[model samples]
Target chain A: MHRSYYTLIASLPHLPLHFELDRTPITRPRLNERLKLLEDADRDVIDQMSAFLVWDRQPLDRNDQEVIERYDNLMRTVSNPLVRALINTRINMRTIVSAVRRRKAGGSPPVGVGQWVDHIRRNWEHPEFRLAGRYAWIRPFQNLIDEGAAREAQRLLFSVNYRTWSRMAEHYAFSFEGLILYLARWEIIDRWTSQDANAGQQRFEKLISETLGEHANLY
Target chain B: MDESLLMILGWTGIYGATALGAVGSIIGCSRAGQAACGAMLDVESGYGRLVGLSALPSSQIIYGIVVTMTLRGNPLTAQSAPGLFAVGVLCGIALLFSAAFQGACCASAIHASKNKPEVFGLSAAPAAIVEGFAVFAFIFALVVAGGIPQ
Candidate 1:
């Protein structure tokens, strides 16, 4: 039902309760409006990532999930390990009505930590599913990954506050720096200066197009 | 008919009384500790970067001693020193119970620190410091009562 995401929207002070309630199936128009907002947000992530790779003189491709995953695997980072993470988790939980509103309207953690966890499960589907997607991104990982490794991947989802999937949802919940660095680690971009080049961009076009666009199609 | 019989009886009372003091204070300390840890965890959630387990268990120790003194020692001395004993015992009881609850506050700080290890490192220090004042008052009463010339 994708309850949490729209539930949050419905609760917005001036937003129509129809967005969360009214019990009607989501219409194509509403979905389109949401997708447009999402694409705009996604483009900002791409632009920021492209700028970072350019600044670092590294190759990047926005369309390839594998490259994105590769870059993401490398550029892994964490900031404000506790409060920022808690806030990020709260946002993921759909606890923050609007980061903007919260700052302007006094938002707080929605209800409970357990509720936050439940919200995360609902949005991402399941940690196992997210883990499967991540595993599938990195090829030749065929022979049953260690259960612990799978668990670690799930933990990293929260550890990284699921910034990757954070974009998958309609809400764009992270900063430019955060998004760029996160995308960079997983190598999801199409242009890189190359592992060896003075000015040549690695043109990971296949990587970027595959990850963001095709991956969505595969699942 | 020897003083040995009196000494055995007296020491047994002292042991029994002190044990009760210890148990009550222990519960207080446990509650205080949980509260402190909870408060700390809520604020910061820094998994492995904090320390304060010591303070969590200290208040009860002080409470036990005070209880021991008030419940057993004070009356013996009261016979010898009349009005001095009553005032001293009165002060001791107040000090002991205050310390017990104050310990709960420190425990609360501990609880908070546990969840959010980033909480002030040795967090909510001022609360503990206040509790320390009450403990000191407790100690002073214990000291004064002990000197009542029994």
Candidate 2:
């Protein structure tokens, strides 16, 4: 039996079954414990997350750019096509949201931001990024951004992302790579929600219900 | 057909069916065993489900054995020997594939359930369906065996 793939996957650890992020600040010890479970292929994503913990707010400072670069590096290293496509959908959503935010501010985005977003925007229709486009909420999100609904667009982006991850978790339940990728995305969302527990709870509750539909028993 | 030839064929049918069943079991068990070992590394509890699912493919061989035994009861004769050989080999082939495919299904179930224990019962449904085909072959062979006289 060719089980090396499964063995590699089984060696990785998973998040607790009853994971909740509302009102609970992520302690360094807790974060580190989670980090220890990931393999080397996911190290850059971990580093980016650690950076984001420090630089949570918007406007993209030098350190935040470093975090983006780390995320880009992590994206490049992912071997699974579906996981890679999911990550691309996230990057596209973020870039579009950031561009909308910058446009509304009536100033140029932080140096290098416009160029990167433009590159991703141009290439999204390419064959390589075709699968990513399938799950992307770009068209409707772009309409929201165009209508000056930046806050709504941001919330909708997260909602769309939650749905994508939920779909992946269901379809790829048997795949180790798919499970790890979905969990990583979920943890990042959890950590983000922890920063503002009240609004996060309301936001995620709506999104979770929408994503899970009648199976929304994940209270 | 020669009387000696008929006797030899009757014996061949008996042994061949049993041997085929053993072959299917060996393949199925090894495949399921690999998945079980992988699942063991993933969780601290609920190992019973994984081990139990792994053993499910072994039933195909048992079905093969039953068919073989049913065919072995009749006396050697040209008319009876050929019918026994046909039923025994075809039934063994069916059981063989069923067991092997069921093993693959069980491996997938074990892999998934190890990660998310909630899906354990649901994941076993596909493997059980595969076993149904083996049961069909086992029953049909037994019924056909009854028609071949001593």
Candidate 3:
């Protein structure tokens, strides 16, 4: 009963690996145009998926409780096993990253967060939350975190997501699952490219402000 | 059992050859044609080749017609009826599967070729092999139908 979108998938340009790309291959508007081919129900699923995964869909200023409630609502509403798995993986990754940041800030294991908090609480003392066996990248990622290499840690996270989605994509060629995986990978690449651009812009602004300050001192 | 019943079954076989083959061709061509249409949207030019590949499964219908004709030439006697039924149904099934699988192969080829045009020829190799199997079924049905009592 799963519908295959041969035309939609074919129309999409091949997305390069996140680290390899300097920019996204397709723009959001063009991608949206292609997505118009999806059935209404599938479009609803996509909207739900974006609500859960897309960065800008949720406000950045929400508290931990609000974010957790949103996640709980998404888990309750989205019935597709594949979409659920994707959402779970994304949340787990976020949980791990959040744990790392909290530990770096010298905070104790968080409370009232949800089920994932238990793992963080249990393994608060361990460097990789004892998840090194399951997540091989965690040890290196933790190392990057501890060394204060924020950009490198970000890149490592992007790489892990890119590789995971790429492997998932192999099993779902020419199907709706394949299209979802493609979109996930595209989102990662888009996020990374935007982040890099933002960083460059910030650096430029900082240099300009310093020059302006120096001129003011001379006056 | 009854001669008339056997004759009716033989008729079913004759019609089933073309009918089943047409059904298979319909499904196969639909699948591959959708892929070809998709590929056409991705790439400019080379549209002819994609459309051509999509038509590869349509050959099974022709093979079915040939098999139908061969079976029809045999007179419906109790002696020949069973042979016609066996040859017709089996040949139809063989053509059905081959054409369906060939369509899948063609679709895959179109997808690959759309991305990397250099592999277009090589990618069609699998579909051609499937067509070869359809040809075998067609030939065998004809040879066997000729041996059936006219």
Instruction: Estimate every model's Cα lDDT from 0 to 1.
Output: 0.38, 0.63, 0.82
Candidate 2 docking class: incorrect
Task: Tell me the tens digit of each residue's lDDT in model 3 across A1-219.
Answer: 699876788677776644446567788888988899999999888888877776533433346786678777887899877888888877777777777777888976654344567987898998888888878888888899889898898789879989998998979867898888888888888777777876557657677778797673464
Clashing pairs in 2: none
**Candidate 1 lDDT tens digits, A94-209:** 22222112322343322322223344334432323233443332121211122325433323323233344334322321233333333333332212112223323222444565
* TM-score pick, better of 1 and 2: 2
lDDT per residue as tens, model 1, B1-150: 355554444444344334443554565455554443333323344423322542454554455455455636444432334334344444445444554555544554454444444675465675567556656655665576566546
* Top candidate (lDDT): 3
Candidate 3 per-residue lDDT, tens place, B71-116, comes to: 8887888888888888888889998898888888888888888888
True contacts kept of each: 0.00, 0.27, 0.46
- Tell me which residue pairs clash in candidate 3: none
Looking at model 1, residue B41 earns an lDDT score of: 27
The window of 10 residues in a row where model 2 chain B has the poorest summed lDDT is: B33-42
TM-score of each: 0.30, 0.54, 0.86
Query: Which candidate wins on DockQ?
Result: 3
lDDT of 2 by residue, A1-219 (tens): 111233334433443333344533334454455446456655554455444334434444334467578566655565556555555555555555554455446644333232255454455444222324553565666668779775666566656666556655655533544544545555555644654557777878889889999889845
Report how closely model 2 matches the true complex, as a DockQ value.
0.22
Residue A211 shift from truth in candidate 3, angstroms: 32
Candidate 3, Cα interface RMSD:
1.6
